[model samples]
Target chain A: MENVLELKNLKRHYPIYGGVFRKQVASVQALDGIDLSIRRGECLGLVGESGCGKTTTGKAIIRLDDPTSGNILFYHKEKKDGVDIATMSPRQMKKQGIRSKLQMVFQDPTTSMDPRMLVKQIIAEPLREQGGLSSRALENRVVELLELVGLTKDHPMRYPHEFSGGQRQRIAVARAIATNPEFIILDEPTSALDVSVQAQILNLLHELQQRLQLTYLFVTHHLLVVKYISHRLAVMYLGKLVEIADTDDLFNKPLHPYTHALLSGIPIPDVQHKLKRIVLSGDVPSPLNPPSGCRFHTRCPFVIDQCKSEEPVLEEVESAHKVACHRKNEVRKLVYDQFG
Target chain B: MPKLIQAEDVVTNFYTYEGVVKALNKVGLVVDHGATFGLVGESGCGKSVMVRSMMRIVQEPGQIEGGKVVLFFNGDQQQEAVDLLQQSEAYMEDLRGNHISMIFQEPNAALNPIMSIGDQISESFLFHRKKEMSKKILEDLSADDCRVFLPLKKLQQTLYTIAADNPKSFILIICSKIPILSLWQRRLKREALQRSIDIIRKLSISNPSETVHRYPHNLSGGMKQRIVIAIALACHPMLLIADEATSNLDVTIQAQILELLKDLKKTEIASILLITHDLGIVAETCDRVGVMYAGNLCEVADVEKLFQNPQHPYTKALLESVPKFSQEGRLRSIDGAVPNLVSPPSGCRFHPRCSHAMEICKQTFPEEIEIEENHMVACHLYVK
Candidate 1:
């Protein structure tokens, strides 16, 4: 499969100031060296706890937040070479048509959209931003976009507050795809919705992806939803990718300790199924002063001396399965033995 | 199982500017002793309102129009059940945080930002356990040989004895009102703070002593939730109502909190009334489940039976709507939106969206029927 987007060691840091003089005391390394590739039309799920920088990575990819270092390569079929968009200004991105090819749907649809605007205007904002569409053309486009997102014809006249959470999310989706974005960053889009409504949105997203051939960077903490929607999964801990594999492979044969813990911790809806949950002991450490060596070493049950002293880079342990752990094999064997 | 709390024909309404929104319409359910009862519903389906009405904590513009919240505090089944709704505000105030306590959805909003975590937890002890704390202070004063000038110590002991006999004593009330004389109960406050530390430690919070001094903002989300649980559990209430207590936290933190609640249920709390929208958490934690829709009780059954053989169409649809990792298919979502409660459907609120709805379902609300052992469904299909 051809790759649509590639992140090369992307880093985003925010400086923390202190003292009377307000000197730069320290920095919060929100995105500390991440590498990822989203294949064309594939839903790549990013799962992590809050403050783990998954949202930051999504923002950086879409250029909503400026990256402190590294390259974001967007491959265009028309152009022979991949374009490095990490350092591009907003004006440059708009000039190069990168803005239209990338869009984002935020987590909270209620807050993301304008309450005063009608649904049609909300969806047509992006199209209007691109310019050149007459009133008749804009109206037709808005109706088409609404229908694509499963909204009724009359919904275009209603305000966002008049719609339910799920419907508002559909409008947000319609707006995101209005510019015909090839890659969309969905940051916890379904987290704020109820289960039944969440199913509707998820199905709509899946259908839209198929119909539009859109690649997605789905960032969420929901394990079950990610397992159901994404083709591949990436687990992040304290700003770095801890593991990446096919969704089924990661769920079935989790090598990284954090990934295993996260998978086991989910509450499965079935009554007959009982998971042998490896509940992690402590909370994720502060990103400002992440633990020395491996960030997860503080809470890892299989921590060793080497894991505390030396940082482990993400290495491919199996075919297409990558993990950043010093004792991945040992942890895997123990988990297998315990489950068996 | 002996009944712990039961809400019968509970009707709650919110009188908004637009109209009267019927939040809870004749909702009824029973939570047995030592069993976790889960109330699962959508956002405005009255799950929270039902519990709030039972606790008599419904905010302004909302009224619990009619209900009998019978609480069986005596686990041995000897004492008569108390109707919480019929009680005076003073009695209800005393009953809350003493026999039945509630944990809210947002820990940040639930906790006071200005107060230290220790002071917040100690407030529960100070409010409901006043007499006990007074007695404990008296005991401490008698046990200690150190003298604060012997006569002053004697006077302090006499004051604590009065506080122990009647917490709302006239002299103590006047003293509490005054600035300088309020120090008379310092020992009692200290005792409550000490008990706060013990309860925080019981929740397995690291550095309980240190955590007590910090504000709510300083602690992590999970730690703040644990503190909220500590405040709820400080008095060791007979019933603990956790309303979406873990919904706002991350999955890992949610797991930790759920595990802690499970352990606490086994050791501390007698019965848990967990209200949430997540069926998965209900399946994992609850012994029995109640499905609520548009202010009405749709179904009630054992957790396993409800999952395996759901009776109501809405319940079945809800179960099928949740995406399963082990299953693959296009999800069958319930068509149409949740009904508006300002003027809900005449009979069954779910009839409009229900696939198996009959003519009778639109005319009158179906009476709850026992389809099997401990399984109750209130659908017109089950009526026949």
Candidate 2:
């Protein structure tokens, strides 16, 4: 499969002002130099704590918030070369209809959809904005989209608030797929719903991915949910990618200290499966004034002098298993000594 | 072990603009003394409502329509058992935060934003320990180490005496309204603050003095959560209900909180009622488990047994839906969403979503039957 999306040194920073003149004193480094790639029809799980910039990465990729710097290389199906989404102006992106090819499912379904608009109108509005369809064709497309997301064809007239949390999410999903986008950014898609509903939504996402051949950037804080859905997992700390590996490899044999601590943190349901978790000390540091060198060094259990001074970039120690840590080699032995 | 709390036939309803929403319908469960009894279910399944009803803190428009929440203070002491439903408002108030306490889900929302952490925690002590503080003051009066007299020493002692005699004294209430007289509570507040610091310190919070003085906004999520737990533990209640206690925290922080709770359960708290949607938390922390669906507890069993041999289809579906670390392929998600509580399904609430749903299931609710030792299930499929 071809690389659907490639992010190179993506940096999205918000300037912080101080004093009477409101001069920019510092920046809230939301997404600092994020480098990643997503293959065709593959789900890449972005897992991190709150304020760890997973959401910012999503927004930057789709240019929901125009990134401060770096390139978001998006591959078109027939195009010889990938286009830089970061450089494209909103009008240019819309004119080329590249924006339609990359759809986003927001975290909260309630606020994501306009409460006043009917479900059909909200789902149809996407197709309408994309243009060139008959009124009859648009109506049929809306019904088809609703049916695709497991909702009845007649739910178009009902408002978003009329539906349950799960149903509202289904409507949101229907809207995302209305244009038949090849790549979708699901930002905490099932976080608002119940577990039973989450499972249903996850299953629906899986089915849709298989049927539609959709590539996904699935972002969430829940490791278990991400583990189930994603083909590969990327662990992020304050504004930077710390690790990337296959889902199984990441969980089974995490190399990075942060990843090791993170994977251990997910409490397994069975008591017999007693996880010897390495709970890192302190909370995730603020992105505004993130720690020197490795951003995770502040909370990383094994903080070497080298880690404190020199920044470690994501490097592949093993095939398809990349880690950003000075002590990635030592982490295996440390985890083994403690948990194994 | 004798049951600390025996909640039988609890029927809670919310009189909303739409209609009377039956939040809990004949819900029943047992929490034994010294055991962490976990209630597992999806949100809006009345797990929270059940615990809230048990605490007699079900908010506005919501009422416990019927049923008894019998609490055994020290267990098997028949004379000590009192149905919380029949208790007077004052009696329930005394029982709440004294015998039973609760830890809310969100630390940020749970803690008072304007209040200092010390003040909020100390309020529990002030509310429950007025007599103790008064007795201490009287004891300290004779000792050489006793602090110097206030501007109104006689008035302060007299106020303490009145407060010690009756916490809700009419004179104190009237005095409380007066600007100058309200200062009488200063000594008591100081003692409570001291105790609050000790309590916060015990929750593994370093720098108790600084943390106590700081507002909720100044603290991190974990610190705020610890402070919440400290407040819940201040009274040393027989039962502590941590309602989704670790849901809003980071994974590492969640592990720490869970560990703290486990440790506290051993020495600090007697019995814990852990109400959460995470099956993992239920499995990891709880000894016994109860699975609720739309208001009805469909299954109750030992945590290990519940996970190993789940009888009810709902429980089975819930456990299967959780994407385990050891498992691969598609998770076995239950069909359909939770039924609408206002007009809940006629017979078995879970029948509409159950795979083995029978004709009888739609007609009447199934009674809870003990299939195995200590394992009880309420499902038509398990019917004899």
Candidate 3:
């Protein structure tokens, strides 16, 4: 598979102002430094707790929130070369047909959609804004998109509120795929729906991915759902990537202490198989003033002297498995000895 | 063990502008003593309605149409069981927080924004712990020889006696409401606040005194959740209804809250009716699980059994729907949406979505059949 999207040390920092001057007192390091790469048709699941910059990374990729620094290199297949999206201004990117190819689906379905617009209008608005679709052609395309997401063609006539939570999510998916975007940022899409409906949406997404060959950056706090949908997974802590590996490897033998703690936190839906949970005490620290060194050292059980003073760079510990921790081998050995 | 709370053929309905939404259609359930009973279902499946109806706390226009909620109360397990539906309004009001309290889903919305955490938690104590506080004060008064305020002490003693006997009486209720005459309750309020501090501290809130003084908006989601749990546990009620208590929280925070509730179950409450749509929560915390769908209890089994050998199609579908870890593939989803409760399908509410839904399933509702010991399935296939 060829690389579709590459993010090199992307950073999005919001300034925190106070007092009379309203000057830049400090900064909320929302996305301090993110470096990730995606294959043409692979699903990369970004899992993290709240305020971990998973959403910010997704938003920044599409230029929804302009990053403070770093390169967003997009590999346009037609041109046969990578174009640095960071260098191009918003206007330049819009004129180059890059905007239509990059689309996003928000977490909350109801809030993301317009209530007044019928399903057809909502789905067609993207194509309408892009121009060059006849009224009849647009109607047919809207109906086709609805069917692709497992909804009936007739559903295009009804309003969003008329649909159930699951159906509303299906509509959101329909609208996202309407523009034929190669890569879609699904930010917590199934998090709001019920398990049954979540399953439906997941299946629909999988089906759509296969049919359209769509690559996805699946962002969610749901570890289990991410493990199921993503080909590979990346774990994020306070504005930094802690671990990234094959989904099964990460779950079976997580290298990073934070990843280990996070995986164990997910409650297994079984009564007999009682796994020891590494329930981290204390809340996620303020992003405005995160921990000094490795961000997770504050909550990590395997924190050491070196972990407190110096940040550990993301290093490949094994085949394609990267971990950001000073005591990776010791942590893995400890987890294996106790849990295996 | 005796059943802690039993609802027999409970039917609750919400009369909206469109039509009468039959939220609970003859729902029957029984929670045993010292057990964590979980109710699992999707959103809009009436899991909340069933629990709310059992507690008789359904919102406006959502009426408990026809059913009896029989509550077995021994407080210390020494009295005859009483039917809660047969009790008077005042008795029910006393029983609500004293015997059975609830932890709502959204802690932010559940708690009063303006009220301090201390007052919200202490209010539970004031409603339920008046007699205990008054008796303790009386014992102290009798022990102390100093009689500086002899007349005031006598008046206070009489007032406590009256309040303890009938907390909802016009004089006591009026006084409890009117802030001016509540000077007598200052000591009781102080005791309640102290107890609230203790409970909050036990919940792992570091600065209990500081937290108690802050409003709901001042606290984080996890802290607010802890405070809500503290309020629910303030009176040590027999049954605690955690209605999706940890749903709105982050994964780590949710893990903490779930652990807290699970730990508290052993030491605090006798029975916990844990209501949530998350199967992982049910499998982890609950001993027995009840699956609801479109106002019907589809399946009831031990947590292990329900997860392993699910009988009803709906239960099977729901269990399979959860994105299993490492299966980065498509899942077999239950087709069709939950039927409109106003005009639900004639027979089983899940027939339209059930893959094994037979002709008989669409004609008449199936009786709950116990296929195995202690495991019941409400499906036509199992009816024989």
For model 2 the local lDDT of residue B195 reads 94
Question: Candidate 3 iRMS, in Å?
Answer: 1.2
TM-score of 3: 0.95
Pairs of colliding residues, candidate 2? A120-A156
- Residue B75, model 1, lDDT: 56
At residue B88, candidate 2 shows an lDDT of: 96
**Ten residues in sequence with the least summed lDDT for candidate 1 chain B:** B72-81
Interface RMSD for all numbered candidates: 0.9, 1.0, 1.2
Worst 10 residues of 3 chain B by lDDT: B72-81
TM-score of chain B of each: 0.98, 0.96, 0.93
**Listing candidates in order, what is each one's chain A TM-score?**
0.98, 0.98, 0.97
Compose the digit string of candidate 3's lDDT tens values, residues B1-384.
Answer: 678888999999999998999999998998999999999998888999998888888999988889888887753253677877777888888888888989999998999999999999999888788888877766666676747488888877877777767655788777767787778888788878888999999999888988899999988889899998898888889999999999988888888998898889888889999998888888999989999999999899989899999988988888777776535446878787778899998988888887887889899999999899999889888745
How far out, in Å, is residue B288 in model 1? 0.5
> Per-residue lDDT for A1-340 in model 3, tens only?
7888999999999998988989889999999888889989999999999989999999999999999999999987687788899768888887888888888999999899999999999999999988999999999999899889888977988999999989999899988998889899999998788787788888888889999999999999999888888889999999999899988888888888778778887877766667788788888998999998888988877677998899999889899899888888899787777654
Quantify all predictions' global Cα lDDT against the true fold.
0.92, 0.90, 0.87
Q: What ordering of candidates by lDDT runs from best to worst?
A: 1, 2, 3
Question: Per-residue lDDT tens digits of candidate 2, residues B30-77?
Answer: 999999999989888999999999888999999988999999976799
Candidate 1's C-alpha runs over 4 A off are A337-340, B75-79
TM-score of each: 0.98, 0.97, 0.95
